[model samples]
Target: MNIYKHTILLLFINFLGFKTFSYATFSIIAIDLHTNESGAALGTCYTKQFKIYTTKLNINLADYVVLENNGFGIMNLQSDINDFTPIWLSTAKGILAQDEPYYTAKVISKFLTQPNQDYKHKDRQILLLKKDKYNNITSEIYHGENVTNFKAGKIRLHIDDRFSIATAGNYMTNTHAPEIMEKAFIAAEGNLSDKLIAALNSIGLTNDLGDSRCRTSEGVSANYAFLRTFQNGKIKLDLNITTDEEEQEATSLLKEKYEFLQE
Candidate 1:
């Protein structure tokens, strides 16, 4: 079905209350911005209690993009184009009702390429990221150590997206939404519920036949996010990273002049 129709349906179910998960909620309509580079992923999800905005901006998406990477970079969730929606609960304890992201540390993943000389040689004394045509982001993944080297996290990311200026509705609160996270998604049998569940399934998520869970598609997907439990730590990738000596200097330079992640 079209997004407009689906959005209206989602809102109805959210406000009217359905016979599924007791705290079933609806996500805001996400509008895919058509712009430079790859593009930007922008959307707004809200309830009377809170509003959430998502800005998966890619630096390359800028008209005259200037990034710390020196060259250009991409930013987005997936490379392809499609629409998706899914609802899941976070298992975090004790902090519902609060409205903010709470990552214990900055998430890190190995990069496809090391940061630019500006970040490395101190040519540009600032923290920067790159984006794609649509403005998603050339996501800078780093090794876990990379984050430990700094000190921040992602759960907080969820908070930032939900309650930051970058998002819609401007929900400026430093609290958590435990009611939204702790509550299980509503996906039993019914008209709207069934339809919503089916839409989620189409996007790679499958209702867990077992108790207390749902499953998502494996491998990289265009418009879906999944959680994977990795047994092996210390990820091994043939990344062309900066040498230890240079990386230290680069880190020091950045600490002096820039902020990578912001609220």
Candidate 2:
């Protein structure tokens, strides 16, 4: 019986991952479904393997519209080196909801890498097989409990569009992984106490976390992506959090405040 259930879950994941967009230089109209009053046209060009998503947004969604164009100029830059390869590295957007249809739609049509005219897209995606609407929902993604620490009086929720990225914030379909870090404190503790979240949300770490390119075991402070633990006697606001060492007190203080672990 357990095996049957597990198989079902895996099959379900097949229904909510990625999408296939046409390889063409075209424009897509993004109408804020929430607010019909505003809309924008995104300029994009797609090749067999690479895609470049672009747009001009004059009005911003007050609280981020799902699948909205985020206006990123260089998810893939058309460099002379990449002239013909069919692979895409795109900006994903959206929140992960375990109960709701929680996946980002494919809205890109550009290429950043080498264009492969003979690139044959044979992989079938059941998630995007629906007529038009995206039906794939997200399963709660926990990297690991040891990877994070939560504070008291504040609930920390961690989510990721691992298999399929969403279009929710910054127009990049893939979310700022560090963003949830900020929201964790804001939603639960009702505070941005310091710029801890803001500093983390900045890019580079977005792809650098865990990736050796961002950090090395030899230098923990030099690397940007980290969720390490700290120790503190007093809960002092981190008015100046520039390095991991500097962030130590603040993280220690937050963990102490929440009492997530006893050490």
Candidate 3:
């Protein structure tokens, strides 16, 4: 991320008071070696009812999922949703510094593990991804000990070792959600965007209330969703969609938007 973008993001975070545990989402990050495109797709059950101190501010939960360096890497920060700007900044710095993904995750873990922090690391779930020039994608996922049930991550590599996919979720209806998403991504045909959308759709198939919290609204999977992809330092596609109304299925709305874009 650049300084200008970073400034805007910081302002947005502060403006919305984004330090809350209302984000219950499932996400997938992947790279397409054939197209040199990297992308992330995610959905959350967040709605107006989930708003905290930022009730008056217009908020987009997608902003919390960091897409840095023009999709060269992505980091999903969930569970506590506290202001981990420092952690994200560190990860961005590590990417810019050309550090390995493992090393960057290690550095961030140090801070997350530190005691007396505003939030406990045991309640946080984070997923990190980095794609090198060779199209080799590295992924790291951390599911805190205290995260709710059905929280887990799965990583899959292409047979040729040219691409990789990573999926993670928390507070889900079942533990098989991540695996289902991975399978959908692999089976789907098209560009990176199509595969990502497929993975997101799988969430709805796995369970009507994929996030479980949506049981209150009887909404399936998510209420807000986003899919973004970049190639060669340029944005290839960016889609952010929310349900027409609360208690609606966001993944369905996302699919509609994605289909329109394809046309």
Candidate 4:
């Protein structure tokens, strides 16, 4: 009886120890105009079990609607705290949710800007997107310095009827990968699945933590695709993966199942 009791106690301890940790310096979120779907891709260096990491990704999708073409915002978080300041402001109170390492949504249709607002923070980056009813998209990228002021950067793109992509984290690659992905998406004629594979292939070798690239070994990275169809209002998680190899393997495993996510 004592041995059984001890075994139960050990199991309880192990259960508690099975927490997940995911962190990243960079990520990407995109919206395909033709398909009315969205994707949030992340590259980081934190470690955790696969189950825990995937759970976090699903939870993030549950928090906001990714299909709305109105407007959306993505903010990087340093902790698990629930703060929706950027989202609330960007969406103008349309939706609210906790920030994640990689976040994307359709919130409003314009960049949320405040004149003379000096917001500065070393920990976070804010990327906002808005697509109006008229089909005009406004993109705003900012580096958070603190609570009130943010340093804004200009994003140049001529998006026609093609897909749109956004990226954040680390240095260099945060901005670089998105541009490459955008080109690939256009080259693929707006095929998201093909675009993703092309982008990954173009990304080449991923680096560990402290290094910047499309892939990271020290942190958890994910690529999530949100889909919406005229038949089914919302078909979420069309394509999702935690790593490059996972992307390749899952693509093969789900080949017969998910014909939409294949290259």
Q: Judged by TM-score, which candidate is best?
A: 3
The lDDT of model 4 is 0.37
- Ranked by lDDT, the better of candidates 1 and 3 is 3
Candidate 1 structure lDDT = 0.18
Model 4 C-alpha lDDT per residue in residues 20-122, reported as the tens digit of each score: 2212333445555566544543333323354454555343321222223222332323211122244333443343221332332333222322432212233
Q: lDDT per residue, candidate 3, 33-59, as tens digits?
A: 777677888877664544433334444
The models' CA-based lDDT, in order, is 0.18, 0.20, 0.68, 0.37
Superposed Cα RMSD, model 1: 23.4
Q: Which runs in model 3 stand beyond 4 Å of their true positions?
A: 1-22, 50-58, 70-72, 87-93, 96-120, 159-161
Assess every candidate by TM-score: 0.17, 0.20, 0.80, 0.51
Better of 1 and 4 by lDDT: 4
Model 3 local distance difference test score: 0.68
Candidate 4 to truth, TM: 0.51
Task: Give the worst 10-residue stretch by lDDT in candidate 1.
Answer: 163-172
Q: Model 1: runs farther than 4 Å from truth?
A: 1-36, 40-48, 52-71, 76-140, 143-205, 208-263
Model 2 spans > 4 angstroms off? 1-104, 107-209, 221-263
For model 2, residues 1-263, the per-residue Cα lDDT tens digits are 12233334323323433122221111111111221111111111112121121112111111111122222110111101111221121122111111123232222221111124212222100011000133232211111112212111111222232111111111122333334433432333212222233233322223332112112332211211112111121212211111233212222333333333323
Span of 10 residues, lowest total lDDT, candidate 4:
224-233
TM-score, cand. 1: 0.17
Considering lDDT, where higher is better, how would the candidates rank from best to worst? 3, 4, 2, 1
